[model samples]
Target: AAVPWPEVYGAGGDSPGGAGRPTRGAGALVVVQDGRLLAHLTRGGRSVLLFSRPTMGDEDGPGATDPADVQAVVTVLSSLISVGRLSPVTVEKVNGTEVMSLGAGTRAWTEAGARFTPKGLVVR
Candidate 1:
């Protein structure tokens, strides 16, 4: 099923001119990596991620506990939790994929607005 999306605005919150509307219920994501606009991924069926070429600063990691990044994630998580949704917390580790203590569906259900999930230790 094809979704619909609104016209993506530019730095001034206006259309980028001759911009085509994307499928809705799809990519409305606001992925902000290191104070830069990385991508706006979708969250529905067969969701896809859309990105931009022009970026700012080096493509370096935001380091664990990044101020801006952390604030963004926490803001999103806090809103969800306040609405009786799911709880979310970032986990720090060296080299291992952290298992979501809340289970797969718990966090994977981002489509249902269940974003921001609490991650457990990355035990290998």
Candidate 2:
């Protein structure tokens, strides 16, 4: 897919103002017949990664997210959960907390990337 120019592109005389308003790209939404699937690559693209790992010689497969990052993620999520700081909490009428956010954009780039989604989604 062709990338839409960043919002800064308008200030540089590329966009016609609103069209140039910075966007984070298609909002990472994937359209499907039944519902809007969370941002993820097609199943066909990710299937190869299930049973295969690549080397310098392999060009057909996607690379995996580094395992070394697991500790970092666990530590952050644990601390956030324990402290109830997953979302912001600065408001007089409505208090919010720090909520961790993740997306499947990484999976789109590599089959080996872990795809994340929100839990407890009740599909009616």
Give the winner by lDDT.
Answer: 1
For model 1, residues 1-124, the per-residue Cα lDDT tens digits are 3544323323222221222333345324444656664333234212212234212434221111123433443355456547765433333211111224223312322332434334432111
Pairs clashing within candidate 1: 3-23, 3-24, 4-23, 4-24, 5-22, 5-24, 27-42, 88-118, 89-118
lDDT of each: 0.32, 0.23
Q: How high a TM-score does candidate 2 get? A: 0.23
List ranges where model 2 is wrong by over 4 Å: 1-63, 87-124
lDDT of 2 by residue, 9-114 (tens): 1133321221122223432212222332212212211111111122233222222223233223323334553687443211110001011111221332223222
lDDT of 1 at 82: 71
What is the Å distance of residue 83 in model 2 from its true position? 0.9
Residue runs of model 1 more than 4 Å from their true location after superposition: 1-62, 88-124
